[model samples]
Target: MGVRGLQGFVGSTCPHICTVVNFRELAEHHRSKYPGCTPTVVVDAMCCLRYWYTPESWVCGGQWREYFSALRDFVDSFASVGIKLVFFFDGMVEQGKRNEWVKRRLKNNREISRIFHYIRSHREQPGRNMFFIPSGLAIFTRFALKTLGQETLCSLKEADYEVASYGLQYNCLGILGEDTDYLIYDTCPYFSISELCLESLETIMLCREKLCESLGLCVADLPLLACLLGNDIIPEGMFESFRFKCLSSYTSVKENFDKKGNIILAVSDHISKVLHLHQGEKKLEEMLPLGPNRALFYKGVASYLLPGQSSPWFFQKPKGLIMLDKQVISMSSDPESKQGVPICTEPESKQEVPTCAHPEIKQQLPVETDSDFNLEVPMYAHPKIKEDKPMDMDSEIKQQVTLVSDPEILKVARMHHIQAESYLVYSIVSSGEIECSNTLEDELDQALPSQAFVYRPVRQRVYTLLLGSCRDDISASLAVKEWFVYPGNPLRHPDLVRPLPMIIPGGTPSLKSLWLNQEPAVQARRLDALLACFNLSSSRDELLAVESPLRALCCLLIYLFVQVDTLCLEDLHAFVAQALCLQGRSTAQLVDLQLEYISPRAVQLGSLLVRGLTTLALVNSACGFPWKTSEFMPWNVFDGKLFHLKYLQSEKGYSVEALLEQNRSWLTRFHNLKAVVCKACMKENRRIVGRGHWSSHHTGRWGRQGSSSHRTSSSCGHSGQGQPWRDQGPGSRTHEHDQWRRY
Candidate 1:
């Protein structure tokens, strides 16, 4: 009667068992309830065991060990209160899969042998008595046969007796296991510690008494008592229906297995079906319990029934008894009032109303019998009245409701909008204007504030607007170096420009002056033309006719080139800072521009700038430079000679070789500058760079590592713009060009 029976079904092999002898205060009341029982006596063969090895069971870990120790000490204290020790075991088995039938049987035999050895040792203990019973499958088979007159192959053989003996001798039939299947054959009262312990022991005793009265059961014949409670009724049929629901037809795999094995497999599947249904709906089983009178009623019925092990099948049961129809008899099947009465607002004075069946009558036929005695019984009118209530159908009803208050959402929303706006701006720029400023207006109405802040300039061209906005914002906001090396507008929109400007800003000369005079206000005219070009809303043809895209682009390029022309400026200003640092006598008077550019550092910057501009010119041949091409100050061949003369005298104390060696570095800077020029030229040209050619151009300059590397940024890519000159050497002009050379 120990924990063996439960263990067999659940497939557990844990060594320890913990049983609650007295639910609340067994030590306090043991003597009063069972005075005849020996002092230190326990329910021998009754123990509760939980197996962690089963798939259904998880290990309780270290805490469970502590719990078991606590229970053991509690039981030892009970011995002090005059209750003999008792044990109840479900059962245990060695682990092996039944797929290999022979090995599984052999392992079961070995496990059974081990159990017998344990039982014999326990049986020798003084003042000990054991009562064990076969329940579950044994009781199920017996009841099934008694009810259905069917035979089952589920019998314990003589050799199997040795295998089952320990389970029957030392293990309690129902005490320790979670299963209710054993109640079918068990002879004693069964209680689950975790659940039933919550109730008072007196209440438990009362429930048990009522349960026995209902079924007419004695504790010794609990299995027979269970039969009265409908334990053997296979509602929803047996295993075959379960197999159909859970597995494919045997015929599908029949070709792969022998006929006998297939039959055996089906039987096994049926067993599995019954076992699962029994566990799955176990709450219904707990309603049955054991005591004295209910057992006698089951014993009186005394019919033996065995279950059939055959093709898996399910029994169909009466799911629900619905009332189909009712008939008003007038105490007769045929009513005399079949004719219809006229429809009227008021009850028509005494025209005999022809009666049809009541609405409830039409719905209650087939289930409720039409007989004289039970015609209008209200009790059986509808069995489903309680089930018709509405249920809460919302999926989120169980979820916690909360409002979002995080600022990260708004920050992200703003960033996203700025990025989108930047793209729109890119789509609007044109080559005709250089000084165009795009003012993005946040047009975000309440509808989609998260998507965008403003509408871009062009209404129809929205395709690239968002992307353009985002690209610009990302470059600006991140502060990545050289992010916008070339930050010119996409291209000057042709519509924004005009035919001409009377005068450029900064008192610079106009294009009219440049074209009209030989040397009249050279800087002023160049500046005037730049301003005019940016302001004019003229097409390329008109602009070229007036002062060419080439002229405008060249002027702009040269101005930037001069500003960043590292070596020329470097050479011109190197001596200024030195003279001041040494407080040397003024050998030569310097101009305002020359005096202000006082550092040798400017020399290196000038070299880089010159090289950069040269590269820009070479690369951007399409529309000329971004600035006016006419403004290019061709290198003076005379300056080269002047440079050589200065080096020979060592007037600057810098060597000629040092200056000459800078050619390579200058060429590299020149290449990158040329690339920018080319892009600007294309920007002016209106013809997009061919996709394949541009990609090749990009890869050749930037390589696969992209624009991140500083040492070898591409010649034409923009990320190279911020690089500063690292080496300063003697000044060297790239090629000796005549000053003021005409194209």
Candidate 2:
């Protein structure tokens, strides 16, 4: 549904812009021309590896590992050729697409089920060992990323937007991903492995500027065109049939407009024209109308254009200085240079410092640039200062210096001084004690309005917790948002209540207090209540069999506390495991029980147990379920109920009786038609006409004896002519007359 005909239209109208080049060629070009220049690129890693997670022949068995290894090697290849790669992973499905997310999740589960079924059926087959299951592949990807030490930034929403944003902000050389939506952003170049590579061993670079030119549209107009054409977030039925093609034709015929031109207004005008051309026909407007559709379209526009407004944390400008320690220097530099240089030490001075400059700042001397300095002494120290007291006569010895004749020593000495000076500057700037001539605000005043810096909105409070790793940081962030930000907000989850302890600072609430401090025995007595709440039967014995019934209860409480009914079994296990770890306990047995027993039971009791729970836990938690809120939700155009008899009658021009008659006529026409295939060519020849035409034209071709030598007025006038039925005089006349009558 992405820009309905975008890929094909672009290929036909603007092939040069989407040009592909080989990997080796691209790498060599950069190597020769932009040597030692690391061109930064944002990678949609998840999109790149999506197929690997799904069951595919090329990505079967250990092939996924090979694929990931190959991906790492590709990144390394770029790094070798001076390309800085920043990998971005999708964290959650966007709020606007939650309905689509749910449908996709359901589809994926069905696919997983199908794969499992196939594996079960082919268990004894030799080729059964060919593929790894989707779940196993997903786990392996995480492990591979960790082992490879690829630090990926997880976007809170659409990774494409984040990739586009980062690429724009940093002026990245390009964005590498499979999504064509990046074309809508029009800020950076885009690269795709599939699009770029003609062969397995080749890669290509595409030209974005040329592509826009070919389409006869400016880059800024793409998003509006995409909305009209339809995108993943917007349904194709939202627009009239063939409207996208008309828009493409319209744009292709016109000159490109400036960015200041009202592109959406132009689209609306075109749409109105199309609507008028098909005045009496049933179109998207006749079904859903324009007012609501326009609003949704604009919402999509705002979402993509102003993604930062949704996730403020990601857009926050990082404020800090990068420290260049010895380890950092060694890692960045070649091994040959690591051991050659000594750490620079400052020379002591006895002279009094000025009151304006702090003693700490004054004592920090710039690295000496001289090449003839002694190796063992500080760069500022003279030979006389080391040997004896620095008298007025000794100062003359320092003035008379000799240049180092060896080029290698001089080069090393120069590098050392450069590194030392860099460290000194960093120390002074980061210390924030030195007064600057102009502040950032002052600089902004002198700058053009477009170049001026905009301040980010400040957070009300900053929570600092020692999260061990990225996973913990994500979990903590989610927990804080659920417990603090969304608590008691009816707009989110109307049934959920905020815990009192979470509302108060420094107040820690135990599971018992949150659940009315009910004892284990008391909770057991009220097990019926828990079952009823989830719409489950009271007599479920598996719940009682666990070693710690309380742990199971705690798991349930945590799930409900998060205010999400549906949860991924893996995520629930992880959260429960973390909670147990905090209480100085192990969740090994509890996690096993939850996966095997409790989760299945919960699913049967009308709870959703999706394979991927991020959509619910993170996405829905951030921007509550669309159906629950008063905001307009797009109708499921594909729903069968929309075409039901009652619904059809509700529409102005549609009726069940008319639909039934149309279906019957279609069926009759389909059955009456006979498929004609040429025996010699083994391909479709032509559809046979009526009985008289077929008998006259095809009798000889089918080796049947039928007046082939007879000279008749309307049939077989070319007697014994040895010509095809189409070319024969009498047969052609009869075929045409029959076709005319049939029409």
Candidate 3:
């Protein structure tokens, strides 16, 4: 999507094209030159997100707590310096970029294969070069920033365009990012986020004017250079003939015939010949041996042109774009219209200009700076204006995604859709589809199973409630259809399978009751119902004894045992053992353990539990979200590599106390929790009858229709052969419900 080899070509060959300067130096110069001005930097958030998350040990999965901490430090560095920051995120799928997106994914697949091979062969984690950003990173970033109280916006379209335009519209210090395309835009200055040493705010800025002067080309000629060098709009192959022609004539520097810098120098030399001439179009057409590209060339140049005039006080003002702040979420309908903040962009009367400060109000004292040159406040303050600075802190309640978009989800999940789950809230939602992470493998090398199938049962239950349905019974969830986006990987399913069956007690509150009923007892019933889905039936007093933080996760493990047949008590102990590993750990203290690739079977149990947790969150979101999802997030509860290491310890028959390496009281707590899980999970009982129904079904009498004289024992309550008439999950529902009722 960028110039094929231009970043390196200019960075190495044409030194004038790129400039490396310290950001602290720039800040000092700004302070010394214009002491009254506040420097504002517009940031491309996606660029920073990939950089921050890529170098970690668990890039394949994620270290969310560490990632969240990195984001806080990044923001505070600017805020403490009195530098205002506005973050823009990429939002929609542009028409021509779909193919580009697919190509990159296929490329990443090759890299991912190499990563798997390297980890297994070398028996260690791969270095920084081999990594891809984990799924749901953007959503996580936005959620974190919002929670951090920072000023941010999700773009209605591509963020680079919005970033460049916003920078130019507001007269920003620069557009801070790593994209080479930023050089092509005629916006404000472009800065390199990669070169930034945040501790001192020292970084490099790309000086476009220096490059233009050195190359004998005008600022207007930048887009033409990008096209001639081969960008996203026009294929590089189309200009191969012209590039070789330029390469042959340039003998000053002996390099590869198709070397990027050599070609850049040659092409610009030719461009200099045609500048301000009558033959500009005719001369440029010669480079297009395939055909003339006046339309596309114009389009590429037009993309760099800034649109509209919405300031930060307003917004980008596109159809689906919304402005986010701590106080409110607002959107603009008309491009030509200005919006809130109660400030004036122009003077009320042209005859008399308004001055910011009166002579009497001018400052007389020299301002003092902090240790890091952090100014106490913005140099110039207005008498009436209030500074609503965001709280500089980390994410306290980070609530956090998925492959497969249901066709029905489009009804409410579209851009500008009022629903909170709508993707429009993101600046740029992924145009392409993704497979769910933590998927199980089948028969060794299939096109990978649909991560959808893994979570379908849970999601379908959620879909039934969120989207509504005619059938009131839980079985109605089975009818919901979800479409998975596998990209290049074709699934091996015989019929793509169907709904994942969710098993919970009938007495659990309905979606309606969870939402409308605000009583404390209703909350207790909701938790009970959630646990019952995993078949962990606990009394209120028993649950109160256990910590609430790990209750949902403990219930999740039992659910995994019920769903996954191969899972044993060892697996249950392994997951809980990691929870012990996470006992009161800080963001800095988290052990960065790595892994050598193993069988999905080795870690598939953890994956299943992870998916199960996602289901719980989705269900919670559908209701009023009474539960704190942050407390139950996968990062807080499980680490795949740590689980595998702990599991091996348990496989050798380690006792619960030995596994946790704790005292007798901890053993008591572990044994008690494990006892509850073991009892409820001994047999996968799909349904638990109500108090009155329980007595009638198991102890009252034998079945009316069959063996009326036989007496049923309480021990045979959950037996498969007994009544054959109760509701079930995985087990079939018999048509004998009417016969079991008492008069």
Candidate 4:
């Protein structure tokens, strides 16, 4: 957005002209040259503090205070050197940039969440980790500036524009920030904080004159180049097609436009020509795309160069100037008050004053009475005007009194003049003293009738034939054993009750005595059915011989499925052991083995099994299935699978394992290499080989040296000197080589 790659490109291209100098050195220079004069610098406070407020810096142990303290010391150092530092903090984002602001806010929230997670996981004393809440950091900065007796301007929109505009209005020394947009605004000087060094504290001033000269373009055409380079309001894609194809042509047009003094028109025409050539005349006819507010994107680009004009997006002039002194700081209360009031003094009178001794002249003044003037009406006037108007006024007042005396007349009068009466009624009602005919509570009671209470019994006794046929000597008992056998009298006949038929024959056997008493053939059939349910074809002896925990776990899972029972940890371990031919293995060891054998395929199977079981459980539960029957349902199978997958992927996934193996192989190969050659050289050669081998590489290197020597000899000969090329001083040759390197 900020002229993509402009800062780096400028620094690299003009490193000699754009030399780095410490801020302290500049302050010293200003103080020594202009003894009593103080150079004021407008600072983009918000932009400068972004690096300090990062999660790594501000989210740890009292860093907010420490950061501001450092900032305070920086401001104080400049103040000591007779440089007035004015800080400008950003305010609400302008309407045009609200979309960008929203995205930034979302990014900030993400950063905050990340910081919180890090502190909770990594810090032993997380409760001590603290920083300024939400907007408190900016407020703290403002407070710090105030304490330092520095004037701080809180911008109404963007601080960048305000900083630039204020610097120009005051003719300050320079504008300081990290923003690259300042390069386009060539008015006043600009410096980037990132270019400053902590050890040297150098400030690299952006030289607009050198930049324009180097680029072969004027200051006015820089914004157009920036537009093509891309900015916040203009998408990079808009000019991406022409960037490589027509950039040189555009630059040439700008450089050759000295014949036509209008640079803007020349650049615009050149752009249209290039577009038509590349995109066709039909595409060129279409209007350029605009910003969100329908402002031409080009206008926003050029607005940076024009000082007084504000861009529809991004830039806006600050409302007023911020000023400060030793005792107090103040800004212009009104933006319209551009001029200062003039002080006036009393002037001496030229005429002589009248004293008491000159009473004769004082008494010559004349006086007048009210009766000296006369008024009259013509005969063409109406009769009412001719007569006294007091009678008519009295008659109208009497009619108003009569209307006020009757409620119906008053109501009709109020309705006829609602606008006048409404204010009076609202005022009275708001005063909270209006009396009503009935209270709200009484009205509510009258509107709603009370309900009466009634009672009825919910239970009724029933007489049955079974109750009458019950034998004597057997007291009725609700115990399950009593229903199956006679009460603890061995001599008494046992009660014979018919058993409920099994819903599905050869289903999974219950882990109870009744199932254990079944014939061996029936038990084998049940075991086979359980194994078949899980798609396992192995016999009991084979399963026991393998003793694989995965198979045992699968068997336990199938048993829960066939019996419609919820899974429990203890029951799972016990059944899994039983499936392993009742092997004597600890639950922990079995669990470890089960986890080791879980593959991606096993995960998919477990996920599907869990999903189907959960669905069946929910359906049966909803259809009035007894809660006692399925209390051990395997509802946590999904959670177990998810945990396993996350652990494996995060800790030992196949991709990660492969990457680790490749790194290990590289390390081993590096260690086995001979010590004579440098690893960096080897790496370079490896990269070069990928591009393709070069033939006669030594010849290419020697040829470059030979050409340089030839040029040096020719220059020496032209100077009428017979000196050899090597005879030149080392420093001079080194400087020549440096220049060649730049080229």
Q: Who wins the lDDT comparison? A: 3
lDDT of 4 by residue, 1-743 (tens): 36666766665444554756566667667667667657878887776765444323222111233444566667766766567887776643333444444444444445444444444456421232443232234444564565557776554335666576667656677878887778777567887776655445567888777777665565655665667666655555666554544544444444433322223233345554543244322321133333231223433353353333322222122332111000011112334322211111111110112111121222211110001110000001112221345343233223322202333323322321221111112111111111111000100111111010000000000000111112333313211111110011121221121111122234433322112345555545444433333223333444433223233334334323222212222222222222222122232332332233233222222332333333232222211221221222231112232233333343342342232233553333222221111222222221112112334332211111223223132322223123221123311111111111100
Clashing pairs in 3: 23-202, 23-203, 90-427, 90-428, 91-427, 91-428, 154-427, 155-427, 457-500
Which regions in candidate 4 have their CA more than 4 angstroms from the true location?
11-17, 24-36, 51-57, 60-62, 110-117, 124-135, 198-200, 244-294, 305-743
Better of 1 and 4 by TM-score: 4
Model 2 has an lDDT value of 0.32
Tell me the spans in candidate 3 whose CA falls farther than 4 Å from its real position.
28-38, 54-56, 92-95, 132-138, 232-235, 238-258, 269-272, 275-301, 308-452, 459-548, 551-563, 587-589, 592-624, 639-641, 663-743
Over all chains combined, what TM-score does candidate 1 have? Answer: 0.18
**TM-score of every model versus the real structure:** 0.18, 0.38, 0.63, 0.35
> What is the Å distance of residue 150 in model 3 from its true position?
3.1
Best by TM-score: 3
The superposed Cα distance between candidate 1 and the true structure at residue 455, in angstroms, equals 74
Give RMSD to native, each candidate.
39.7, 32.5, 15.2, 39.1
Candidate 4: clashing pairs of residues? 21-202, 21-203, 22-201, 22-202, 565-633, 566-632, 566-633, 567-632, 567-633, 567-634
- For each predicted model, how many residue pairs clash, with residues at least 3 apart or on different chains? 126, 5, 9, 10
Using lDDT as the yardstick, the better of models 1 and 3 is: 3
lDDT of 2 by residue, 92-203 (tens): 4444564555445444434434443443455321233443232223323433454456545544344676677677656566787776677776556777655544234344
Overall lDDT per candidate, in order of appearance:
0.24, 0.32, 0.50, 0.35
